[model samples]
Target: MDEVEVVVAHSERATLRVGDVFLKVDTDQARIDVEVEVMTLAPVPTPEVLWRKPPVLALAAVPGTTLGSLGGPSTGSPAAWAAAGATIRKLHDAPLPPLRGRSGRSIAALTAELDDECELLVTNGLLPADLVTRNRQIAETALRPWTPAFTHGDLQIAHVFVEGDEVTGIIDWSEAGQGDALSDLATFTLGHEEHLDDVLAGYGTDVDLDVIHAWWSLRSLLAIRWLNEHGFDPFAPGCEVDVLRSRM
Candidate 1:
């Protein structure tokens, strides 16, 4: 009998690993719909879908280990990171997914949500007034219009898998859609600022550093409250709080 490993579990969804297979149990079928659809449309390598039973979508685990995770030291070589970057560029160049920008959200909607979160951070004393204000101002640069691309809307480093400096697969496609390319870049290099140059090198394009900086601040500010509520520590070493402090 294969031992069951609880990969991740929260109020909204959970992932379980049994042997070489991964079971993604999501309450929202719409997200599952997107995940299944985007995998077919995306040009990049993805996990093999073994089966789906409503809430439980089974996937065959892809080869290679993860690229590392947030608040943790990265183990992949510079070449591996570059390969990940190149893979991302390929995905961006692919045709848009069936769904629009990560749940069809517009820049205006995101801006409004950002402002509301900033206000809450200040009003509830969750963060220092000065810190929230400064980051909020910095976050404004990311609010402007951007060209939509096929984006891994939540392109965290851990989502990418690599083998011997080659990208094997990218996962977590529920957020994949037509969205800002820089948004994906910002998420990938959020805390790993040292790897930004390497990523951009393989990305092989010019990018707005200020906009990247803005996304860092904006993403951290919006995420702190949710993380705190969701049994995660935004204030952990090398985590969201540290990322925010770096801007100051």
Candidate 2:
């Protein structure tokens, strides 16, 4: 067996090599800080493979252990939720560069992506028909008249680090883009409903709760379907399924 110097490891991602420098950004007044690491993996022939490449060395200086860790504080706790909310606000407040690839500015494009994902999952027998219908309806409802903001598409406790009542940093930028702020907020709420009020309060604005709830529900359903189709059990540690299920 070979060994690699592991800096951080979770079901979905890992980081190694401490001295590797990557892109870092912080917006304190807005309350966000990010560090981006270039991946060391060699590029595969396929573009799809390229999209799936891991960071060569990824690291984010978040405060506490991930909220979803077995022995860590539950994300449902008010303080924990507040911390998560603050972290998200910071991310949202950060200055964003133009989206590199496809412009995610269109609601139609976003809806199409969601629909296609659902269809693929359904075709593979990974999602129940009723759930698919519900998910589609919710996705459509939530996406209509969407408002764009710098968003971390994957906003979950696992990607967030907290210390006491403060969020130190956020990790993972693979799913980031300029998109609906509410969608990002929804992702957080769905994954951390236990801290709903505190999170919203930290957000410092009145948000449409229904839209956020719908988006989160749809996001969870999609995640479940993807896990099922991929033969990945959500209950296992370090698995995307586990992260999603933990939110529930």
Candidate 3:
């Protein structure tokens, strides 16, 4: 294999370097098996408050290159959806380390966080109070029967790599945690409904689609509420709210 070049770097966690090996960890997971070539790590500046730290290394092969991010269209399409579902199922089946943090699966806790975020946004004059309330209701109503499982909190098309009908690799383990499995499914389903059945079929088990749908709805509301309060349009490309709304 040829050496992959370092094309992009994200913070201090990971860098996309040239000549790096892309080994497949099962059918879902993939990682850089080599040390980064550069020493200086940069910080990502953003106003969005996060629940956890991002990954250390985030890299992918160049498009049309030997080790590109697999193949197929980028996001929310049928091919991308199938790949995402397959990858997530594989990840969920992997053994996980013991969780050592408070759970975010509870409606009250999620609502509290949403409330605080709304207050912050309103204080900054970014959104209306009524919209915040509406979003809160949506969140509370959507997240029912809170069961937790190991979830890829940031599951999306860009995070998954596909080559034809098979999933090449699943990338980005930053927001991973012990949470509701359905939430992970919902996270993907919210964007690509066409592949919902296929994705679930890939799981090879009976999963409650309603539960997944609820989780997706609640997640969408929370994300959109945050974006709206921050004075940014929630429908922009790469926007979490937009991705969620596409499902609705």
Best by lDDT: 1
Write model 3 residue lDDT over 30-124, tens digit each, in one string: 22211121101101111121121223333343222111221223333455455556566765665542441122346667667666765764676
Indicate the worst ten consecutive residues by lDDT in candidate 1.
96-105
Candidate 1 versus truth, CA RMSD in Å, comes to 1.2
Q: What is the lDDT of candidate 1?
A: 0.88
**Cα-based lDDT at residue 23, candidate 1:** 98
Select the stronger candidate by lDDT from 1 and 3: 1
Per-residue error at 88 for model 3, in Å? 2.2
| Worst window of 10 by summed lDDT in candidate 3 | 37-46
In candidate 3, how many Å is residue 227 off? 6.2
- Order the candidates by lDDT, highest first: 1, 2, 3
Query: Every model's Cα RMSD, please?
Result: 1.2, 9.3, 9.9
lDDT of each: 0.88, 0.53, 0.48
> How many angstroms is residue 129 displaced in model 2 relative to the true structure, after the best TM-score fit?
1.1
